[model samples]
Target: MNKNWSAFNIVSVVFGFTFLYLPIVLLIVYSFNASKLVTVWGGFSTHWYSEMLSNQGLMDAAWVTARVGLLSATVATVLGTLAALTLVRHTRFRGRTLFTGMVYAPLVMPEVITGLSLLLLFVSIGFERGFWTVSLAHITFSMCFVAVVVQSRLVSYDMSLEEAAQDLGCTPFEAFYKITLPVILPAVIAGWMLAFTLSLDDLVIASFTSGPGATTLPMKIFSQVRLGVTPEINAVCTVLIGFVATGVIIASLINKRRMVNNARTDADI
Candidate 1:
């Protein structure tokens, strides 16, 4: 029985790893391929990377996407933090459950529904679908992710600290800024990073909201891929993968360091 279980566990672990990482491995390998066809690897070369950099349209689209991601992430983080604070701290309110549901509804709702609704709203309102529209759509979805992250952090938080600050004569606003904010800032930052990544990766919502002139990198890549595989797209994907990996690593390190410092402080106390 033990032998069979051990073998099963080993197989499960191997399958899990393969399922999660095989696509990433393939993407990285194809990014280095010199051939235009993704499956056919002619040879390894940095030529595609150079070509990607030189493509003016792709570059512009990338810049636009970055700007939209940054702006939307910022907006989402702020709004989400506020929503989390309200939901966690203020317990007594009429329609509070409804409000909370509305705030988090996007997280569970289908992306297609969200995209279609936003597109229809934009059309009805006569809003020109472009960068701002895309940013707004991103904020709507990304804010829910931020809210969930911040709320989880807040759940583990001790409210007595804020009360202690207030008892010492600090105003509520000052107490939040000096005490509550410090404790939750790491989570807030993490939420912001999460929002940024989601916004950057979003395609369906952006496609629905974006106009012709404000094409994002993902939109451009999707258009190109319909025609055939291109080394340039692989190169772009490689860069995106690198950026996301670096961001995740940095965030993990920062969280680990904070945890270590917190443990030491607790020991001292």
Candidate 2:
């Protein structure tokens, strides 16, 4: 904690960040390489980025990934929040333990098993695998993570505020919408972001669930990597990483602003 501990603090911070970001930095840098080979960088160029954008297959996959991530994350956040509310509100309901277990079981389950189980269920029901199936699979697993994030906040939430609003003749939905939602918006946003990132980065589950015309970005890059990692791949990855980083920064800023506003309102009250 001491600023006087300069050497130890400097070493720790430098090492920690270097360990985490060096590979990413290298990857980003190489994405601009003029050479075709990923490792042998000739000089800086934007050709790879141009090529990556021009590739129809890659662009289509990116579009599918974006749509799947958006749809699944939104739905997962809604369902997960509802599940968390059930756990937090109906604390004494019958079969609550079983329900809780079912809701959260995916968090600890192996991706392979989850994917396979979903595959089997789909097959049994005669459902076709495609963009919809991939999206469904992502939603299935991502909701559990959202529930975990939301439940943590809900557990510490002040329910009296909602009850007070209801006592003032506000309907349950109105009370929740006007009072509870603003307070928990940050957690919901965080959960949505987590679900989006998970769906975006998922390879294993997507592999099992995806069918023709449903190839995700990760799957595309992975399948191509078997041939070789090219500068184009690096460019695509850099773009994906940039997109996620931007989203996280924007969400964090919004969450902080909301928290500050809530604090000011609370102080006035």
**Best model per lDDT:** 2
Error of 1 at 101 (Å): 1.5
**Residue-wise lDDT of candidate 1 within 130-238, one digit each (tens)?**
9899999999899889999999999999999999999999999999999999999999999999999998888888988999788998888998889887878888998
lDDT of 1 at 200: 85
Model 2 stretches with alpha carbons more than 4 Å out: 1-6, 267-269
Please list the Cα RMSD from the true structure of every candidate, rounded to 1 decimal place.
2.0, 1.6
Model 2 Cα lDDT, one tens digit per residue, 1-269: 78698997899999999999999999999999999988997998999999998999999999999999999999999999998899889989889999999997898899999989999988899999999999999998999888889889989989999999999999999999999988788899899999999999999999998889999999999999999989999999999989999998998898789879989999999
TM-score of candidate 2 on Cα atoms, chains taken together: 0.95
RMSD of 2: 1.6
**Each candidate's TM vs. the true structure?**
0.94, 0.95
Candidate 1 stretches greater than 4 Å from native: 1-5
